[model samples]
Structure formats: structure tokens, C-alpha cells
Target: MRFGYFLSCEEYSPAELIEQAVAAEKAGFDGIWISDHFHPWNDEQGESPFVWGMIGALSQACSLPVTTAVTCPTTRVHPAIVAQAAATAAVQLQGKFVLGVGTGEALNEHVLGDAWPSEDIRLEMLEEAVELMRRLWSGEVVTVRGEHYDLDTARIYTLPDEPVPVYVSAFGPKALEVAARIGDGFINTSDDADTVREFKEKSGGKPCQGGVKVAWADSKDEGIDHAHRLWANSGLPGELSQVLPSPKHFEQAAQLVTRESTAESIVAGNDLDAHVEQMRSYVDAGYDEVYVANMGPHYLAMIEAYGRDVLPQLRG
Candidate 1:
């Protein structure tokens, strides 16, 4: 399976993000997944730049394909605008960018003070958003009115020479069905075989990608501690990202997670066993690729370990 890396919304400067993308590609990663966030989960996490801008920068620095895992086009940004951005990015990356999208989390969507809708409503919006984007990409004037969005005679002049495949990020059954129906590809962070299988079945044989986070270090304990301090917020699944109004909420929930939880969730302690186990689910589920999202400070070393200590065992 192709191996990739996730660029999360942690403490990464723009230069560092580009530097890490280059490092990941040089170390043999196939692609990179970047988080699209207006704010990091917490102040403790800090530093989120406009993801489209950074994708452009990565295009200049790294040859690997990029996916924003993911950008929600429903409320925060109009679907037409996202269409333009994705097309432009595809041009810059020479057709190596996937427009990964979802219904979005509240932290980013709530910025306009728009009331967050329920799952069903969000799915409805997502369907319209996808439809809108597809129409816009045909390089014709799009004038339409939908339940959630209305566009006048709008057109995108700077269309990409190549089409940007749209990848959908999904977690639930209904959402998975939507991804299957509309997405060119599917992306997920979990390594559960059954879950991936369920999604793939619904996806109608579309390409799939799985990504998991790990904190790497010489000591397993050190790695778990780092994971707890930095990524514990992820434990609260189902867009807990929507309810959290500010960084302080993340800070508070982050405290609820312990080092043990992280250890249980990820491979650690320089043991190839854990990483191997992590890859098994996606591999067994027939994913086209599996990505390792390094969750701690020592990303450089983690990529090195994957290239040296990890990949060989998987290939063998």
C-alpha cells in the first residue's frame, strides 16, 4: 500500500510545515494530509494558517500529493469559493492535489455565529455543496439556488488543466453512504478493519486512504506523554470540534485524556508491532493507501523510523 503522512493543526510554523513535507517526501512518503482549521484545537496546540495557502507552498517545496483532511464547504466557506481554491491548488501542484472535504466542525464553521445544524441537515448541505462544486468545475457559468446556497452567474476563469479528485472524510454510516455516492475517494483516520470495509463497500470501489497518528520517541513512555499533551483532544470523536467554542474548552477536555489512553490508541515504544497492527486494518480492508500522521514534536525522527525500521518489515 502507498504510505502517506498527515500534517495536523499542531505547533507547526509555515516554514516547518513545508520543511516537514519535504522531509516526509524525501523519506519516502507517498502523500501528505493537511488539516484545514481556523484555530488549533487549543491554545496549547497553537498555529493554524489558511490551509489553501500552505498547500500552495507545499506544492512549491514537495512533489507529494496533498489533501486537506479536510475542508468543510458547507457554511464557513461557500462551495463555489472552495471550488475555485481547489482548482487553483491543482494547477499549482500540477494535478497532485485532492480536494478532501466534509461537513466541517463547529470550531471553524461557528465563526460566523451561524447555528450549527444536526447531522441530517449537515449531510443535506454537504450534498448540495458537492453538487455545486461539480457544476462549477465544468468551467461554465453556474447560476443556481439551493436550500443552503445561492449563486449568481459565477464562473471560474483560472480552472486547472487537470481535474482535482474530491475525497470525502467520513465517520458514520450515513456519512459513509454520502461519501460513497459522491466522492472520488474516501479518507479516514481510524485503522478499524470493519469500519474501513463498511466504508469501502459503500464507496463503490473508489480509492480509500487511512491515516493514524503516533508520537514517536526512544521511550514509549515519552511518546505517550507527548501524545497525551498534544493530541488527546482527538479522543472525543464525532466533531466534538463543533461544540468547543474556544481553545479553553479543548484545554479542559484535553486534561481528561491520559498517557495510557494515547498508548492504547497508537503504536509506541519503538515497537514495529504497533505500527504493523495499525497498518493491518487498512491493508486488510483493501485501502489504496495508509498514512501515518505523526502527532508529537519528533516528526523528523518518526519519518526516519518509518523509512528504516518500519517500511522494511511491512514490505517483507
Candidate 2:
């Protein structure tokens, strides 16, 4: 299985993100996965750089393949615009970019004042958005009047010779089925073997990608504190993440998530065995690729530790 670093655009500045990319490649990561969001999930997380701009920088600064851990093309931006952006990124990366997309979260999409649609409607919109993007990527002028989006003779002027592969992110059975039917690959956050098995079964064996969050620090307590302070929102159950409307609301909801909960959700510590076990769960789950986002300040150290003590074991 291939391994990658998950660049949390919500948590780091643009320059810091670039530095991490360079460090990740040097540390033997196979690629990088970047989260694309207009706003951080909680104010404590502190930043959300425009992913396209950061991606352009990464293209020049590093040689690793890049994928949006998942971008929402269904709402915050028009699929046509996302098509153009993905096309440019693919060319910029010399065909090494994957456009990972999802139906979207209310935190990002609700800012435009568009009422967040139910999950069913969001899935429908996502399907149509992917179709429109594929059509545009084919270098054909596309005009569509679909239920959720419309295109008016839109043609992408610049594209890689091979179309950028679209990886659809799913957390539910319905969305997983949709991903299977329409996507070039699949992306999910769960490391559960059942979940990964189900995705592969439904997707007819397309590449399955998983992402996890950890807090790597000199001590377990320090790691726990970092995770509790920054990622407590992650412990909110199920659909809460998708439906929470803003960072403030998320922070409010996260108040219910205890420090212990944060530690449970985020594997935090310096124990090499603990770190390896967290990743091994994904590898054992049948994920073709697993990307990790180190949640604390010791990012470079985490990368070094992974390179020296983690990835070699994984590869072996």
C-alpha cells in the first residue's frame, strides 16, 4: 500500500503547508493529500488557505503527487469552475494530480446563503457535478441543464493529455454506491475493515483511499493536549460534521466532546508501536492508500519519525 501525508489546509498557513510538502517528499512519502475548505472547522484550527493556490505552489516546490483529500464541487463553487481548476492543477503537476471531491459540508457551503440540501439531494448534485466536470475535461464544449447545475457551452482550454482522475469521497452506503457508479476511485476517512471491504466490493476494485488524524509529540500528554485543543470537533458524532453550519457552531458542539474523546479519535503520542498500530489498521483494512495528518506542532519530527520508524515497517 502507498502512504501519503495529509496536509490540513485548515490548520496551517500557505507557507507552512508548502514546507510540509517538501519535508514529506524528502521523508519518503509517496504523495500528499490536501484538505480543501474555505473555512477552518473551528477557530482553534486557525487557517484555511485557498487550496488551488497552495496546490500550484506545491507543483513547483515538490515532486510528490497531490490529491485534494476531498473538495466540494457541488456547492461552494460551480462544477464548471472546479473543472477548470482541476484541469489546470493536473497540467501543472504533469498529470500527477487527482481531483478528490465530495457532496460538501454545511460549514463551507452554507456561507453562500444557499440552504443546505438533504443528503439525498446533495448526492444527486454531486453526481451531476462529476458528469459536468468529466464532459468539460474531455475538451468538449459542454452544455447541460441538470437538476442541480447548468453548463453553457463550457470548454476547458487547458487540460492534461490524460483526464485528471476523479476520486469521490463517501461516508455512507448511498454515497459509496454513487462513487462506485461514477468515480475513477474512492476516498473515505474510516479505517474500519468492513467499511473498506464494502467500498472495494461496491466499487469493483477501484483504488480506495483513507485519511486519519494524529497528534505526534514528544509525550503522550502533550499530544493529547494538542488534539483536545485543536481537533475536539472531530469527535462530534456522524452527520454533525457535515451539517454543522459554521466554526462557531462547531466549537459549541465540540464542547460536548471530552478530552478523553479527543484522545480516542486522534491517536496521540511518541510510542512507535502505537503509531504503527494506528496506520496498520488502515493497511489491514484494505486501503490502497492511507494519508496521515499530524495534528500538533511537531510535524517535521512526525515526518522524520515516520520515515525512520514507521514507513519502512509499513513498506516491509
Pick the lDDT winner: 2
Candidate 1: clashing residue pairs, number: 1
Off by over 4 Å in 1: 237-239
Worst lDDT window (10 residues) for model 2? Answer: 260-269
lDDT of 1 by residue, 72-158 (tens): 999889999999999999889888889888888787788888998998999899989999998888899999978999999999888
- Give Cα distance to truth, residue 308, candidate 2, Å: 1.1
Model 2 regions more than 4 Å off = none
lDDT of 2: 0.92
Give Cα distance to truth, residue 227, candidate 2, Å.
Answer: 0.4
| lDDT of predicted model 1 | 0.82
Question: What is the clash tally of candidate 2?
Answer: 0
